[model samples]
Target: MTISVNGEKKVFEKAQMSVRELLDALEYKVGFAVALNTTFVLNTTYETTMIKDGDALDILAPVQGG
Candidate 1:
């Protein structure tokens, strides 16, 4: 299936993947906030949440002050 990650298109081998799997595969930082299909995905619920095709995801990380 095809999906968009941070505005870039990506094709996955399977149609469904949990948020944990997605983060692991994409190598995004664990502290980042993830928005899937315009909805925020809680860090605690990533392991149980499922991602589908054509989903638009935005992974944002916090930056500390200097």
Candidate 2:
């Protein structure tokens, strides 16, 4: 399956994957927020949220500035 992550196209070997699984596959740890297909995804539902082909995922990390 092909999905756009943070505006970049990424191809996966599976037909579908959960948000949590995708994060793990990409080696992403805690401290980030995700929006799927322009909708915000709850952190509690990451393990249950299924991601399919052509889906768009935006992962954002908090930034601190002086």
Candidate 3:
């Protein structure tokens, strides 16, 4: 499947994958927010949120600014 992650296109061999799986495959650390196709996905639901082809996934992390 092909998906856009943080503005970049990524192709995967699997037909479908959960948000958690994708994060693990990409080696993402904790404490990040996720958006699937422009909608926010709760952290608790990551394991159940399935991602498909042509989907857009955004990984946002908090920043410390003064």
Candidate 4:
């Protein structure tokens, strides 16, 4: 399956994947927000949210400045 991650194109071998799986694949360990096709995905829903082809996922992390 092909999807866009943070504006970059990425293809996965599987036809579908959960949000949690995607995060793990990306090695995301810290707090962040996930938006699928402009829709916000709750952290609690990560395990249930399924990603499909042509989907756009935006992973955003908070930044701190001095």
Candidate 5:
């Protein structure tokens, strides 16, 4: 399956995977919020949430600014 991560398209070994699994696969830090196709996915739901083909994901973290 093909999914776009931070604007870069990449192929995955499989299409069915939870958000947590996906992040784990990419080694993303746990402090970030996940956006699936522009929608926010709850962190608690990541374990049950499934990502599919052509999905666009953006993992954003809090930034400090004054």
Candidate 6:
């Protein structure tokens, strides 16, 4: 399955993936929030939310600024 992640195209071995699983697969290490296909996916629901082919994912993390 192919999905656009942070504006870059990525291919996954599975046709479908849960939001949580995708994060684990990518080895995400920062505090972040995800937007899937233009919809906000709450962190509490990551395990249940599904990601499909041709989807767009924005993995945004908090940035520190003065």
Clashes of each: 0, 0, 0, 0, 0, 0
Could you tell me the TM-score of candidate 2?
0.95
* TM-scores for every predicted model: 0.87, 0.95, 0.95, 0.93, 0.92, 0.91
- Model 6 whole-model lDDT (C-alpha atoms): 0.94
- Residues 1-66 of candidate 2: C-alpha lDDT, one tens digit per residue: 999999999999999999999999999999999999999999999999999999999999999999
Could you give me the TM-score of model 6 versus the true structure? 0.91
Q: What is the Cα-based lDDT of residue 7 in candidate 1? A: 95
> For candidate 3, what is the total of clashing residue pairs?
0
Cα-based lDDT for every prediction: 0.89, 0.99, 0.97, 0.96, 0.90, 0.94
lDDT digits (tens) for residues 1-66 of candidate 5: 899988999789895788998999999876888899999999889999899999999999889999
lDDT of 3: 0.97
RMSD of 6: 1.1
- C-alpha displacement of 60 in model 5, angstroms? 0.3
Mark the regions of model 6 whose C-alpha exceeds 4 Å error after superposition.
Answer: none
> Candidates sorted by lDDT, descending order?
2, 3, 4, 6, 5, 1
Worst 10-residue stretch by lDDT in candidate 1? 23-32
Report the lDDT tens digits of candidate 4 across residue range 5-46: 999999999999999999999899878999999999999999
- Per-residue CA lDDT of model 3 for 1-66, tens digit only, reads 999999999999999999999999999979889999999999899999999999999999999999
Q: In angstroms, how far off is 55's CA in candidate 1? A: 0.7
Cα deviation of 63 in candidate 6 (Å)? 1.4
Query: Can you list the residue pairs that collide in candidate 2?
Result: none
Model 1 per-residue lDDT tens digits across residues 1-66? 788998999999988899899899988765789999898988889999898998888898889998
- For model 1, the stretches where C-alpha displacement exceeds 4 angstroms are 64-66
